[model samples]
Target: MNLLAQTTNRVPWQRLTTAYGRGTDIPRLMETGQYEEIANLIEHQSTLWQATPWALLILLRELAKQKPDKVSSKEVQLYLAVASAITVDHMDSQDTVGTMNELLDEKYLWPEDEDEDELLWEEEEPPGYAKEAFFSYYYFSYLLLKDAIPIYTAIMNGNDKLAPAIRELLLLLEPEGVSE
Candidate 1:
């Protein structure tokens, strides 16, 4: 399906875009570099809780569509795990240990039967630089994924007011040494 058609067919996308366009001043906030303000608006006006799941699903669905043969089952599992970790449950639940364990297990492109903690800690200690690099990569990935939906919707709707700020943020989050 075409990109627009694929986007419109998803209920979550429709709801998120509708709520954002009508209730949130994304354009103004983006234009002004008021990320905190925009975040507050999203928290109050948009169905953000619902949108997170929908966004992850949409990303995986799009990936599947683009490369159905290459998108392995392990990748899908990892996507779901990462999405779960970033969702509301992360804050509300006491089972973070179990949840994070699940996340580590699924995140590997190749599924490993061993426990994640074993690989992360029990094995030889990873160099400090490696750990720092891993943390940086994960942090930037989270930021991009979290911000992608709003930015994309804003641009698609001709909301140029926020475009420059969004582009700036995207640039900042882009991996080191990578050119926009």
Candidate 2:
């Protein structure tokens, strides 16, 4: 099925529209099934995917404190594994892809509501290797979130330290660096 039909069929079109902005029929646009465009929109919309290195490190630190359990522990470990892979992949390709600064400038973030012409100037030109690295990073990061939400919901419902720990970890991963 088309992405738009899938998204609308799964989520309320109104809520998706409100969150993503109006006039642009995201669901309709996604009907093309072009993975790259879908990826761009996902990266642009989600702060979690764009988290800084330090923020991700802090999240790992907090997650380290949590006790091992059947579900949440496994999920957290899975996320960390994926994150580590992305990091390793980035590092290995550093020579060809240039530094993280270059990758961040080119492939990391997406533009906000702006005209194509304006976006052209604002967007960085990523090398082929850099684009590949980013695509790997984005795909795994997205999968991690998909795994986290259910665990988060369960933690929230339970009266355990797990919820608070996860909340702290998420706070650490917030867009703005942690406050002093």
Candidate 3:
């Protein structure tokens, strides 16, 4: 199956909502399946929308499916953009990731059309179970990339624009011989 189809078919889009509206719109652009709108849709104010991983996982799974010899520069950079978003958005433990994680786990908090401003305090104190569910899935995304380091290095070799982002990801990873 194609990456866009794989993601849409697997992830329950109706149950997911972006700040703008329902997540149904994601597929219209993703049909191209070529890293169309990561910069605009996934992160805002330096935070990944809780809904991002649905789109992200499609790209990720596609990359994970590639052999290193077949990886292209665009594909590598697309992965970099995704990984960099994860790193930059998660950069400060107390800020971006912390807040986005909190939101991802929030299963039942939606504002009425009139209460547009109420989302602030609700996010600050999500129910405990929400936090648990969010982290469980968020960390799992790293597991998906364990074998893709070579892909990252390949992108770094030819693209200087992504060096800092690549370094941030490398630092988060355990070194080859280290044990946790």
Best by TM-score: 3
Models ranked on lDDT: 3, 2, 1
What does candidate 1's lDDT look like per residue over 19-60, in tens digits?
A: 233222444543454435444433333123223333333443
Model 1 lDDT at residue 66: 35
Per-residue lDDT of candidate 2, residues 1-180 (tens digit)? 111111111222222111233213444533443323333333343322223221222233333344434335434433433333333223233334333223344333334333443344344752222355444344334333433444455554563645665555344333342332
Kindly report which residue stretches of model 2 are placed more than 4 angstroms away from their true locations once superposed. 1-74, 77-130, 139-147, 177-180
* Best of the candidates, lDDT: 3
lDDT of 1: 0.34
Residue clash pairs of candidate 1: none
Clashes of each: 0, 0, 0
Cα-based lDDT at residue 173, candidate 1: 35
What are the per-residue Cα lDDT tens digits for candidate 3 across 17-107?
A: 4445445567675665545454355544434444566666665656655554554555444444444444422322332233323433335
TM-score of each: 0.24, 0.28, 0.49
Candidate 1, position 13, lDDT: 25
